[model samples]
Target: MNSAIESLTLDVPDTAAAQAFYDEAFGLGDRLRFTTTDAHSAGFRGFTLSIVVAQPANVHAFVDAAVTAGATVIKPVAKSLWGVGSTLQAPDGTIWKVATTAKKDTAPPSRTVEEIILLLGAADVTASKAFYVDRGIPVAKSFGRSYVQFETGPASIGLGLYRHASLAKDAGVAASGSGSHRLVVNGALGTAVDPDGFAWAPAEVRAGA
Candidate 1:
């Protein structure tokens, strides 16, 4: 029952342009360019990113399950290059490829975190904490209702439950919405976003890694 962030993907308007932007900017993973007739593509590991354009299915179910509370349907599920899937609009307005599992798991994330640390907002922290604890991802640490850490994943991942206001406060910015990005890598470096919107970058790792 360790529901870790095995992988993450997204849907973009210009696949080539976006992919190139990521490559030049972050320098995370290699280029895994493929086309999905219904607007689908993925960018593998990069400087600070690991997710791609191939996500697990159940786009609606995901939203229903509250995995994505403010998430919207950017593109409904339908046929594509590999099979069935959809382009979803994350709460942050970021598009994701909610593709069917039939699509091969292309970009496996880095083992850096070993466990995924998900920080939920203050309001949802309590109940969400119970949900993961019950599901079996060990809740290892807690800082009042502000934060709760869960032991999860093949990598050392720990999901946190917290509030955006607090996170923004730490970041020295006005409170805005948020979203999750799936990251993949070979050896070493693991990445995660802190209470602040800024990413807690993973340490450098090897590629053949």
Candidate 2:
């Protein structure tokens, strides 16, 4: 079964505010599925959304737009050992990492952000990896106790696991209690919770979707 992520649904106190922030900031205004609810309290603290780009120029553009749209910049855009990137918190308190595989170039290629990668902070990477693998999602890359990148089916977004505390610090957010995460994944795992409290649900697919 080829299950892909359809949307990253967010349940915020004010759906309009959160939706507007993303739309105005990253053109992702339409990508999110917003629901006003207290089922999962405000100030979500578990997962992160990674916005990948093909060019450094696009990374810079994205970070800049995020800041302009009221996102708190945690790490400024700069050359990192991994690549060119920046980390910030959105108005709704969700952490976002704008990055590209390309290194720092005097003139990075031009592009825009369109991709979304979901990173789940696992209390135990090994256990989390085992959970998903057992559920049929294949691992694209693994770093033993450190990390695991899952390879979802066609049209699905990227999924990865990082040590909870470490990832929270990296994204500059609190690694606290988890309930209804206000996050969703369209996958074969169906509606369930991983070992670390993250939830996954089936995505609705339309004609040709």
Candidate 3:
């Protein structure tokens, strides 16, 4: 059996507002879902949802839409040794990163997201990597104790593990946070919480699946 993250359910205080913002910003379609909750969450959620695009133009397009939809700019769009990217916090307090490795635009600017990655900030990357591997997810890439990327197959969203503090630094936020993660990962890994307190529920069969 192949293991993968089927989808992510974000707990927001207002589902309607979240729906509107997501639609206007990235047009994620069914790639992400939201539920209503009055959960007390503060500071960084110990995770980030990254929208990987094809080029800088595509990155700018999504960031502009997100800003127009009321997202707070956490990090201004700029060129880095790795790529061109920007960071923002959603109205509901979820952190997001829009990035791409291609510095130049090959095609016209559009909101074209190549991949959606869920990066979890773990206190111990090696331990967390072992936990996932034991659950049947294979490792796609590993950088010692700093980072780990799992092979979640082509049909599912990408998953990765990074040092907690480093993850927060990359997102341009402080590492201190409390309360619920306000996020639930649905996958074949069964119902369980990882060492970092990320909740995972059984995968649900969606319409297209």
lDDT of 3 by residue, 1-209 (tens): 36488888999988999999999998987777899777788888899999999999999899999999999999999999999999999998999999999889989898877999999999999999999999889999999999999999877889999999999999999999988999999997879899988999888876787
Task: Point out where model 3 deviates above 4 Å.
Answer: 1-3, 207-209
Q: Which of the two, 1 or 2, has more lDDT? A: 2
Best by lDDT: 3
For each candidate in turn, the TM-score is 0.39, 0.87, 0.96
lDDT of 2 by residue, 1-209 (tens): 47456667776668878877887677864357777666745444678899998878888888877788789998888887788888998876678899988785556555466567898888889999999889888899999898899887666667899998888888876666555667666556679888877777777657797
Report every candidate's CA lDDT: 0.39, 0.77, 0.92
Residue 145 lDDT in candidate 1: 66
**lDDT tens per residue, model 1, 149-206:** 6655454323556554664343233454333333231111235432232233333334
Error of 3 at 203 (Å): 1.6
Pairs of residues clashing in candidate 3: none
* Prediction-by-prediction clash tally: 38, 1, 0
Task: State candidate 3's TM-score.
Answer: 0.96
| Model 2 lowest lDDT segment of ten | 105-114
